[model samples]
Target chain A: MSTLKIEDYDRLRSKLPNRTGGWVPGTAVYCRGYDMMDDLVGRVDFFQSLVLNITGQLPEERFAKWLHAAHICVSWPDPRIWCNQIGAYAAMARATVNAASSFGNLAADSVMYGQGTLPIGTRLIQRLHTQHLNEKKSVEEIVDQEIERKGGKVNIMGFARPLASGDERVVAMRRTAKNLAYQDGAHMQLALAIEELLYNRYSETMNFTGYLCAFMSDLGYSAEQVHRIFALIVVNGVTASFSEEAEKPVDSFLPLRCEDIEYTGPAKRALPDMTDE
Target chain B: MVNRSVKSRKEPFVKKASTNIWQEQPVEHNPYLVEKTHLRGYDFDELTQHCDFTEMFYLLFLGELPNRNQKQLLQLLLVTFISPSPRHPASRSAMSLGGGKTFPQHILPASLGIAGGEYLGGRQVQLCMQLIQDNHQIIPALWLEEQEARLAEADKALLAEGRIIYGFGQQYGEIDPYASLLADKFLGKSFSGPHLTWCAGLVEELKPYCIGWLQTGIVAAVLCDLGFPPHAGAGLFQLIQAPGLLAHGLEAYPKSRTEFPFVRDEDYDIVDT
Candidate 1:
C-alpha cells in the first residue's frame, strides 16, 4: 500500500500551487516577483524577460544580447532546412500563421537535430564537464571514452553534425560572444579542449549546440534550463520561411509529381476474403 | 579556423522519399494528379468496400491486416480509451482552447501537444513500451526483488509526489482501477502475448507497493503484443485518443468561455519560493 493519504490529493482540489506569478485581473500582472507592467515592460529586453520567465532569474543585459545573437545564428530563413520546410508547406496549405509557426516548431522537436537535441547535447556536455573537473579525466580520455561508448564511431553529439563537417554557426557565435566581452569559463575551456582534440584527429569541430551549452553551463544553467531557454530558438526562421511562402501563390512550394515518391511495397494484389481467414 | 575546411559530409540522402505503405499512380494527362492509390498493395477501392477501419488501421501501421483476435482486441482497446477522461490535462486544453474560440485548426495540435507530455500521456506509453520490452523476460517477483532498492527510493518520492515507474504507479493517491479493467478486456484473449502476460505478473508483484498497471502500461503491452515498435507507441496512442480530443474540442467550440470554470484569484495560490 501507498504511504500517501487521500489528503495529498485533497489538499489542492480547486487550488493551483503556482511558483511563478499570475495576474489579479484588475490590479497588476506579476512575473518572477516583478510587476509585468511596472517593472518589466520597458525596463528589460524581451530576451531578458524570456530568461526571467524560464529560469526565474533575470539574466544580465549583455548575456541576453548574446542569446539574441545566438538565436539569429540557428534560425536562418532557409526552407531547405527540415523545420522551415514544414513552415513553408503549412503556408502553402493556407494554414494560419500561428498554425504554420506552431507546426514548424513541433517539427523541430526531433531527436536528430534542431531544438530536440538541446537536452541531449546539454546532458552530454555537462557529463563530460563533470568527468573533466571532478574525476580529473583528461580531455583525450573523455573523447576516447565517448567514441568507445559509441563503438568507436566518433559520433559524439557536439562534435559531429548532420550533413556538414564543420558548423558555421559556432564561428558566428564565437564572434558574438567576443563582441559581448564574454570570456570562456571552465565549461567553455573544457569544450574547446575536446573540440581541438576532435578537430586535430578526426576533422570534426564543435557545433553551435556545443558552444551554447558550454557557455550557458558556465553561467550556472542546468541541462533542463538550457533546453527550456532555447526551446523556440528556431521559431523566427520558421516564421520567416512561412511568411515568404504565405505571400506567394498557394501550392507552389516544392509541388511534387506522383512519381516523386517511390513506392517500394509489394506489387498490386487482390484483397483476401473477409470470412476466409 | 580549423585545419580542415567546412564542407558537406555528402551523406547519401535519397533523391525521392520511398514508402512501403502507400503508392499513388499518376494520371496519363497530368503527373501531378493521382489516377489511383493502393495501400499495402491492396486496392483503395477494394479496401474501402471490404475492410473495416480497425483492419485498415492495423494494415496501415503493420503493413498487414490484423488476425481475428487482433481486430477484436484493437477494437475493444479503441473503445475503452476513446477519450482520456475530461479531467485529463489534454482534454482540459482542448476544452479551454475550444471554449476560448481559438481557431478550430489550432485545437487538435494544442491538445495533442499537451497529450504528448511524459506524465500519463503518449510519452508514458512510449516509455512503458520500452520498459515492458526491456524487463518482461525475467520473472516478475524476481524482477521486483532485483529492483527493490530503486523501488524503495521511488516510493519516497511517490508519497511526496507521485512517481510512475515507467507507466505503473498511483494516480491521485490510489491504484488506477480502470487500468486493470482495461487490461482485463484482453488478458486471456488469444491475441494476448507474453508482454501482456509478463505485465500481469508484474502487476501482481506490485500489489504490495500499491503500484499497478497504468492505462499507458496496458496500451504499451497491447501495442507490444500487436508488434508495434516502441517509437510508434506515442503516435499510436495519440492517434487512438484523437477522436475524443477533437470531439470534445469541437463540442466546446460554440459554448461561452464561461461555461467552464476558470480558477479565481484566491484559488490561484502563488507561493513564494
Candidate 2:
C-alpha cells in the first residue's frame, strides 16, 4: 500500500460536502464530544469514520480500543475548558466586529467599536472590576458612573434602581447594550456580523479533535487501528438516553472530514494504488 | 444624550398578523434531541453536584457534556439574554392576558415571537433558533435551492439589488473565516447524536447551494447543534453582535449620526443608472 500524503488528504477533503456555513446564527461552534457521538455513531464513529473515509483503511480492534480509551482518559479534568469557552465567546464577538467593519456605506468604525466594546466591556467591568468600586456607593450608582465614564448614553427605560446597582445594573445594562449596539436600520448587517463571529470562533477549535486523531496515527497506528480506537471511545466515552441501542458495536468505521493515519517507522511503503490522484 | 423615548412606536399598519405561516406547518420533533424524561439511575441534584450551572446548560440545551468555556458561556449568555423580560413589549403585551407570566410555557413562545423580526430586539436569536430547526429537517442542498430561488426572485425583482442577502455573503466579501474556525473548535466535542447527525445531514444537503458560500451554511449548522431554535437563531445573533452595533451607534451618536431624520431620497433609485 502507498503511504498517504497530506496533499492526498487535502484533495479528498475538498470533495466532501462543506456545510460549515449552515450553523444557526450567533451560536459558537463548540460541539460536546458526547453530543457528536450521540448524534453520529449509528452512521459512523466520528474519528475512525472520518479516518476510514479519508484513508480507505479500517482501524484494527486493538488500535481502536487504545485510541478510544486514550481520548476518554485524556478528556478528563481539562483546565483550558473554561478559558476555551470564554475565548470562543470573545472570538465570536470579535468576528461580529470584523463583519461590520467591512461594510462600505455605514459608519463602520464607530458602529463596530461602540457595539463591539460596550456589551463585552459591561460584562468585564461587572465580572472583574466591580469589586474595586467605592463601597459606600451603591451598585447602580457605580454602573451609571461607569457608563458615563465610558461616554455611553444611558436611557433608563423601565427599571431605574436596577440600573444603579452594579450587579443588578450589569444585567439590565448588558441587555440594553446589546439592543443599542446596532444602527437603527442595520438588522441584516448586524445578523451577518454575529453569524460570522460565531462561525470563525467555532471553526478554530473544531480541528483539534481531528488533530487528536492524527496524534494517535503518529503513535505508530495504521488506518484500521485508528478507526477501532475511535469506535471504542464512542462506545464507552459517551452517555446517552438509549444506551442499549448506542452500545452495539459497528462493523465499519464511519468516515469524517479530517482523517490522518500514518504507519510507524521510516521508509514506510507508500500505497501506490491508494495514491490515486 | 439625545432624548429618545423608549416607548414602542405605534405605526398605523402594525397590527399583529393572525396567519402564522410557521405555526401552520406541523414540525415533527427530531427524536434525537427530545425524549421522554426517564429517571436514569442518577439523581438530578447529585448530577448537579458534580457539574456547574454552565455545564448544566450544556446538558440541558445541547444534551451533552460541556467541552469548552466558550460553549458554556454561549449557553449561559443565551439563557441570560433570552430570559423573558418582565417589562418588554411582549411582556407588556402579555400583561393584557392577566397577572404575571409563568416559566417555560409563557416565556418560550413569547420569546420565540420576539425573536422573529427586524424591528424587534431579538432578531438574531430568532434566526439562530430557526436555523437550528432548519438544520434538523432541511439538508443543505434543499436549503440552498430554496435560498437561491428566493435570492433569484429577489434579485430579479431588484429587491435585494444592493443589499447583502440576509444570511448570505459578508462584509469582507470573502468566505467567512469565523464559521470554519468555530466548527473546528466544536468538531470532536460531544453533543446530541440526532441533532449533530441532523446538522451533518444539513451540511450534506446544503453543500451544493453553499459552494461559494460554504462558511455561512457550516456556521448555521453548528449553531443548530448548539440547540438554538431555527427561527430565534438570529435573535441570539443580535445578542452576540450587540457589541458591534453598540460601538457603531455610540460612536456615530456623538457625531449626530442618529439625528439624521429618515427621508425619501428620490435620487436613490432602485435600479442604478
Best by TM-score: 1
Comparing only chain B with the true structure, the TM-scores of all models are 0.94, 0.38
What interface-residue Cα RMSD does candidate 1 give after superposition? Answer: 2.6
Q: How many clashing residue pairs, candidate 1?
A: 0
Docking outcome class, model 2: incorrect
- How well does model 1 score by local distance difference test? 0.86
Model 2 chain B weakest lDDT span, ten residues long: B18-27
Q: What lDDT does each candidate get?
A: 0.86, 0.34
Q: Write the per-residue lDDT of candidate 1 for residues B1-273, one digit (tens) a residue.
A: 464347998889989989998999899999999889999999998999999889998899899988888898788878888898898999989999999999998899899888887777898889889888888888989988998887666645443222346778877667789878888987887877899999999989888887777888888888998898998999888888898899999999999978888888899977776
Query: Model 1: DockQ against the native?
Result: 0.64
Tens digits of per-residue lDDT for model 2, B1-273 = 111123222436422333111111112563223221211222344444565665554544444445664464355344433323343444333332223222222333333344334322344334433555644466655665666766556532122111223333331223335544544444455443344455445444533333122233333444555655565355444444333333332333334323433223322222211
